[model samples]
Target: MLFGAKNSSNPRLQLLKDVVLFKDLSMRELAMVDSLMHERRYLADEIIFDEGEEGQGLFVVLSGRVKIARFASPLEMLIELGPGAFFGEVALLDQSVRSAQARALEDVQIAVLFRAEFYSLLETHSAIASRISFQLARVLAARLRQAVANTDRHHEAA
Candidate 1:
């Protein structure tokens, strides 16, 4: 099946249930989010976004996989994202350039939300903004905790 082609009654609703960023949203809020986002499909090996490029929005993986890579001194594999995962969130929050490159590892379908649309939606729906802010904070906290844990592990190894 090609990415973004699903048989579900409501693909956006299904996505909301699967993605942490949207899990806290109500049905109405989900519908709002659905309206602001667009679905796109990419073939395997396609470049979703290149590093250092201006990031317009974030992408939620609907199906297939993606690899997040960076080039520092030498090329490095940062991480791989699968279904229900998201990337480019930092750019959404700050409107900065992307810190890494994302490439499709398989035929992939993704839901993308542009910064202007997202901010406009948030302005129109305060509850949706609250929910998204809460989720983003949680994600950031978790990542910080993970970084601390990794640092401790490295220190212990040394």
Candidate 2:
């Protein structure tokens, strides 16, 4: 008999369960959302996406670290994220240019939730979509608040 032949642990499903965007979802609902995800991998120092490119979807880091940077005069490094963290989320709400470039700091695995698929979920599985949207809103709001706090701190130091 083959081990993990009939009952296997799915790594992707396991990763999705811990993601903040799907934290409120039950296992069955996460399985539904998992069905819509696309997976991609990147090597160390690879450009996952570039600044100013049209955003397509949100990417959740499955394994390894990713750096988010703004290619401006000073070349600011926005954030570095690891497993369970999601980025490019604004794309899910609108057709917009990516504000930062994401590059792999190490070998990375990511799961993508495209805008179109998320929209389809909103229409077909409204409850699941609503929960995700709520979580997304909370994440955005917290980021905005943190930005404001950081700006204030910078102003005070200068």
Model 1 per-residue lDDT tens digits across residues 5-110: 3334466577656789888877767877887788899999999999999999989999999999997778799999999999998877886899999999999999
Residue range 1-158, candidate 2, lDDT tens digits:
45322113456878888899999999888888887888899999999999999999999999999999998889899899999999999999999999999999999999999999999999999999999999999999999999999999999999
Q: Each candidate: RMSD to true structure?
A: 3.7, 3.3
Residue pairs in clash, model 2: none
Q: Least accurate stretch of 10 residues (summed lDDT) in model 1?
A: 1-10
Q: Model 1 has how many clashing residue pairs?
A: 0
Taken over the whole model, the C-alpha lDDT of each candidate is 0.86, 0.92
The best candidate by lDDT is: 2
TM-score of every model versus the real structure: 0.89, 0.91
Model 1: lDDT equals 0.86
Number of clashing pairs per prediction, in order: 0, 0
